[model samples]
Target: MPEIKTLAGNLTFTECPRWRGGRWWFSDFYTHAIYSMKFDGSDLQKEVDVPSKPSGLGWLPDGRLIFVSMKDRKVMVRATDGTVSVHADVSAYVAGNPNDMVVGSDGVAYLGNFGFDLEGGEPFSTTNLLRIAPDGTVTVAAEGLHFPNGSVITPDGTLLVDETLGNRVSAFDITPTGLGPRRDWAVFGQPPKTMHDDVFAPDGCGLDAEGALWIADARRGRVCRVKEGGEILETIEPGTGVFACMLGGEDGRDLIMCCAPDFIEHKRIAAKEAELRVVRVTVPHSGLP
Candidate 1:
């Protein structure tokens, strides 16, 4: 059995756990804040606060941090002195709020959207992925996605995007020009007629050195380690709300999770309780943020 441990708690909805510079960086969704802490929970610091909600996180090779300012449909770059500036204005292409993002090795960032006004109780819809180059150029990477959420880039430069409402994970080959084509990397459940029928609602994801994906299944309350074509290798139950996860630690085998009682914005904000939990795994992390 994998032994799970709590690193921090009493947060306001944590998502996007990232391992960088020997620390864990994440975002508190409703609180509109970004944070970083040591693996043992020391030296905790609030990095930045977005006026709008924040979710996915990425970093350029030069050490600049970029986070998805969900409501504004923009990715903000943070300088060393704490100056946050708009790196990409994606409003022209995105109809809904941006969600998870991954920074490619080529300094390109791929972002996703919620595809519907969930907070406003709007019906679900399909959205596409946006590619933001280092030069701030934005273009469509993939389309017709059912709420693309967590994503990661493999050592070979393949992009894996988890479609939360679509019950599948999509794959793409990223190049200097743009993405090549879309393929089904993993299919956990059947094609749901509607988003409401999704079973393994894959959320945030992380890649392991062994080419396996550790995905957070929100509706099922577990972190599932799956291989190509949707083979379930293992499952880690957190017994709470698991929104996102990452692999990082001294040896890079630490599997961390963002845990709370629920994902509803009202409940998370009102409850004011979330935690970062970790477990030791055999496979060290591999791939881009």
Candidate 2:
């Protein structure tokens, strides 16, 4: 219920905001760059450059940073010493570009795909979810998904993924090898028709301590908190395109939203200028990465 404040300016399509090592890291999909900043928007640094576009971010138990390379359809990792390398190649598993990802406690990274083109083109509808192991091996975890975007693993090792095109969120039991059969976790009834970019539809998300899902509703310009039974608990409206968000601030109660300019009339245009913003809320839950 608070107005969102701009944290940084001049971002070219920011997505996948994650909090790690006392810093907030994110990617500019258009610029193909990864950046990090302090909670107060200080000491901004360019972490690395990626091939094509980069989205979703995760960290290994060994302190390595992992992110999805969209156009390349691969998972890349950056070491603490600033070395970058390909962690997994999943071109054969994903139908389109890899979009967002979440690292599990078992050290495996669960990734989802954009499932289609965004520039007013047709989607590959064959989009699927993949799991990348610590040894750089890739395997299909789920298939026939309608553009799997933001995803997170529960504290008990349950994998929950947001199906943007299908307007629902699904859950799967996590195993050492891969994911189990999925069940319905939540669904967004009657998503706004103004939504176009399937990749940014129900974009980024976070998990609360009680296992509730907080989704950044890009097209609706709001953040919705949903229960495990697909019930809407609350909705926080942050004007503009709420591309992504993360829970970070002094008390770990603030929600930082990565928002783009309104595009109601120009949904097909690929203009940037999305501002990185933050808003404080009464909820005091620290988020899971």
**Top model number, TM-score:** 1
lDDT of 1 by residue, 65-123 (tens): 99999888899999999899999989888868998999976679999998878788888
TM-score of every candidate relative to the true structure: 0.97, 0.89
Rate residue 196 of model 1 by lDDT.
84
Residue 95, model 2: lDDT of: 56
Where does model 1 exceed 4 Å of error?
A: none
Per-candidate Cα lDDT values, in order, are 0.90, 0.76
lDDT of 1 at 42: 82
The number of clashing residue pairs in each candidate reads 0, 0
Please give, for residues 1-289, the per-residue lDDT of candidate 2 as tens digits.
Answer: 6676788877677888887777888988767799999888889998989867888888887878888888877788887788888888888886567888988766788888766665457644546788888888887888877678888777777888887776778899988678899888886564423234343356688877666777887677888777877788888876677867767666767778878765332431356577788887666554357
**Pick by lDDT: which candidate is best?**
1
Stretches of candidate 2 off by over 4 Å are 123-126, 190-201, 262-272
